[model samples]
Target: MILRQFLHREPVAASYLFGCGGNASAAVVDPVGDIAPYMEAARATGMRILYVIDTHIHADHISAGRALAEASGADYVLFEDAEADFPFRRVKDGEVLELGNVTATVIHTPGHTPEHLSLLVTDHTRSTEPWFVLTGHTLMVGDLGRTELASSAEDGARALFASAQRLKQLPDHIEVLPGAYSGSVCGRSLSGKPTSTIGFERRFNKAFRIEDEEQFVA
Candidate 1:
């Protein structure tokens, strides 16, 4: 698999481009700002952008996902229930997007927003097991995303707790690639580091380690 992370300092958000290099197929996630970089990356890597996905509607910064998708003739993707003005390909929970030898399985993880989702990626060439997860603001390095972004704090917290539990079921070795880092307002105690693993976060991340729903909400 070929993966590239685009870290935006102005918005303090992270976007991704990844797929099967051998097949020359790729996907972009949570893109922000200029779309030129994404297009250039795909060109340089000899990959065609098949899908452009936005994990959730962003309240922090304007997204370039649609623009990029249109530019590349790729499908613009979002959760089935996401509220958006433009047309997009709605994906359901557990839906798998194939990129030749690489696959991205969708997982509903609403917390920061009602339509929030994460991508569990696997490379068939490497192993059948998942390699990493693109956790868009739901789970971060040192903190969980703030609960009140799209709904009541109590309601969001309850939903987030359930989402966390679902994520906990994944293998411990899978990597965690979050949307934002320390400077973003989405999480309170986020780490500067943009990536982590399930096992490490389960053991050390304060918010992620909380097993009790009440304790986590509080």
Candidate 2:
């Protein structure tokens, strides 16, 4: 499997393009401005973009996901419950998208938003164990996403607590590739570093370490 991360300085967001290099199939996630970069990446890598996914609808910058999908003739993907008028390839929790030897499994983690999702990726060539997670706005380097973006803060917090618990079940060594870092408004106390391992966050991230739902919600 091959992976590329696109970090946008202006918007303070991160996007990813990754897939099986041998099969030349790829997927892009949480793309921001300029579809050209994604197109160029696929061309340079000799990979066909099969899926363009947005972990959830964005309230920040306008998304380039649909535009990229159209430009590349790839399927635009979202969670099955995403509240969007446009058509997309709806993915459900536990559904797997295959990219030859690389596979991305959907995990519903709705807290930052009602339809938020994360991708647990594995390369069969390496092992069945997951390698990393593309955790949209749900989990980040030093903090979890802020609640109340799309719902009441209390309600969102409750949901986020549950989502955090689910994520904690993953192996500690799995890497975390979050959508945004320190400067983004979605998370407070975020690390400038864009990536971290689950174990690192579990130990160092204050909000993520809270085990009690009531304490977490508070």
72 Cα displacement, candidate 2 (Å): 0.3
For model 2, how does the per-residue alpha-carbon lDDT over 153-205 read when each residue is reduced to its tens digit? 99999999999999999999999999999899999999989999999999999
What is the TM-score (0 to 1) of candidate 1? 0.99
Task: Tell me the whole-model lDDT of each prediction, alpha carbons only.
Answer: 0.96, 0.95
Mind giving the per-residue lDDT tens digits that candidate 1 earns over 85-182?
Answer: 87999999999999999999999999899999999999999999999999999999999999898999989999999999999999899999999999
Worst 10 residues of 1 by lDDT: 143-152
Clashing pairs in 2: none
C-alpha RMSD for every candidate? 0.6, 0.5
